[model samples]
Target: MEKFAMKKTLIALAALAATTAFAQSTATISGSINVGIMNTGASGAQTEVASLGGGANAININVAEDLGGGLRGGFDSQIRFNAANGDRNSAGAVNALFHTANTYLTGGFGTARIGSIVEAGTCAFDPWGCTGGAALQAGTGISALGGAASVKQAVQYTTPTVNGFSANYTSSLSARTNERQTLGVNYANGPLALTAINIKGSGNSTTDGGTAITDTATSQRAIGASYDFGVARLSFLNTVNKGVGGATTADFTSIGATVPMGAYTLLAGFNKNDRATANFDTKISVGVNYALSKRTTLGADLFRSEELAAIAPRTGTAGSGFVTRIRHTF
Candidate 1:
């Protein structure tokens, strides 16, 4: 009789403890590995498969804790690696073990994150994320400006969506020469999303054994929009960069489209940069993607880039090449 009473008491205590929990926590691991061979430069090209962040190879660690009442805290860290050799990325290149790590908090109002965040102003009108061979970056005529691969030691905030409208702001705490402060506003309604952004930064050449000097400020203003029509989506982007030293005023434009057909996707985009004192260039790329599964993709692309006589890097350089790629995620 005494043992029976003790067992009942232990069960009651266990049930009470279960009902009094104040928070919940979760951790998830997700990553992708992309392998491809392509000629990304204008010179001699080689077919190598070890491209980290060249297209899509990344690992992400996400952890979150629910603090109840629609508030949560989390941390996110994404690292880039080469699939061929397993080397990590640093300084946008595969060198170290980690790349970007940040923390975030979400509440009824919105979500905010800091530490190595992505640039917010460059993807307003890109269908292919403004990257890869079939995106704006593959085009020569478009000189994309004021987009950081990732911001370090930064503080960022985003407002909750209200009727498909949201706002975002980011400022870097790093006291570098070209630290950026960015502001962006976004609106999404059904298949249409629009964006407006402003970027301001100041930097000058350092002299006398890394001594700081003053230089003119660089500013960028941009607006872009995209619409999806089920079968295909169209995108347009434009930007103006001012105070770029010798170039002075530079203007850029890009337009692209993506079409979905069963398990395949068609990608196309064009980019151009126009600066009076500099050389003119234009880039065009077309690609196709085959989705093997929800987390696996296979694709190929062909790019044709042209440059004028004045520029040293691409001057009188015109070439076309192809790349085949595969991506798998877990």
Candidate 2:
């Protein structure tokens, strides 16, 4: 079943590509290579080797066409490779098959995308929307929890801008038999922007034996905004998730800032997560980047996280780490 699904997705992407090429008769290829090394200095920490002696890399290709009536369609894909072991980051093969990550159509009404990609909630709440760059939390964060990356079968739609405001909706259809939906509204004017998203998931709860036990429902609300002030930009994000029965509820909040000076930029951020059990965690990070040229940069980052639990003081420990990386665009 999974193979068939993948095949169908590929066919759709191929059709989209063909249409784009025929309509515009133009093609352009571009991507980036990022290499980084991470190191840790804490008690009992292992002296793991640092550097691109072993690293990961990503490549992407995009094709689009301009249609009449101000409409356009495109196909996008990406592949991640483990330069150390010469293996692909995805499942199945050494060099994973090129998967259509973003195949969509756009017009004056906005855009709609398909394939394995982020739901609308993340797009609305993330500081970086569809712009693929190091500024994205998923691309630069040291901890997975700091970035929410989920791939599911989804359909999304955005509305045309009205007075600098627009709305979006996304629905997920998966065999897990769960249905997830998200709605968001965005406003952008001058150097200020704001977005809010509400998400809900519903399905049948299963027991250990896989038997349906009860109806399960989950909901989340997130809001994020940023303001640019000439030399700096400040951003904040807040989210709350609610679950019933034996499920857990969670709340998260984050604040960050970026300042640019000449060819160098500074970034700092703080985030907190609280669970239903009252256990919480906090993370703080600071990073700096120096532009090597128009299309290249070198950066250094440091991050630390601490657990805060009343009953498990011993389980709570602080971790600090750093990474040095180089990014190049072609």
Candidate 3:
């Protein structure tokens, strides 16, 4: 029965791609699934879990059509699933099959992207996000609680780079809950890149579940830069998250480097989260990857995190994590 179900899912995916690309000028299917053993907080005083946890697996389909006059249109859709059980990733109250979806148009006026789109301030420079290694926490310090990288009902625009500089803006076009807006500007030339991002959301005016609430404005502003030397690349990012309604604010700083060592590459990263509570948390990650081919790799990362400020209400703790996996891409 399990094999039958898996076969049906594959058939459905192929059919969907066919229908989407029936009349498009160009279409492609690209995705990867990494399967490996993962252990988190196994012997620590905190929680414990042992399962098949690797980087998120996805099936992506993209189609594009040239509309002439220096204009083009395309649509991209992605399905994220757990490699362990083949279950979809649930966000908010919905278990969406299409985790990432966007339709875009490009021309002389730059590019306009609509629908569920990538947030403006999320990882434009992170080598991990752009394909480096399989360190599950690739974007750990970028968003709140490692939330989704894309938002719904989002519309965004990117300006054409005149001299290696560009700007972009995005906003959730919804007013029912809270208004969210993001802005980013970046400069990239040669082996250097710099980016600044600001994300703000209007707070709620009413209370829910009998909790009184005030203030509807919260924000997270960050700046990041990176330089690549022939031997190794270094990057740094600092983020300040203004808590909800004058609560506790936090400043998160992350630094990472990727060094190429012949057929093997070394990756190291350090993250510090300083909260208004005076106590803080620090995490260090290091890993090495061996390239089996141009598109395949075998890698393992070791991570340890400690909290001086209580992770629980008033208790500080330490945790360890390890994952080794084989990742392939097309």
Number of the top-ranking candidate, with lDDT as the measure: 1
- Pairs clashing in candidate 2? none
Residues 250-318 of candidate 3: C-alpha lDDT, one tens digit per residue: 677777788999989998777777773333367677878899998788777776655422445654455
TM-score against truth, every candidate = 0.81, 0.71, 0.78
Model 1, range 91-154, lDDT digits (tens) per residue?
Answer: 3322434456788999988988988776566554655553444457422234443344455577
lDDT of 3 at 115: 87
Poorly placed runs, candidate 1 (over 4 Å)? 1-20, 50-55, 92-96, 138-148, 177-179, 202-216, 244-249, 276-279, 307-315
The 0-to-1 C-alpha lDDT of every candidate, in the order given, reads 0.67, 0.58, 0.63
Order of models, best TM-score first: 1, 3, 2
Estimate the TM-score for candidate 1: 0.81
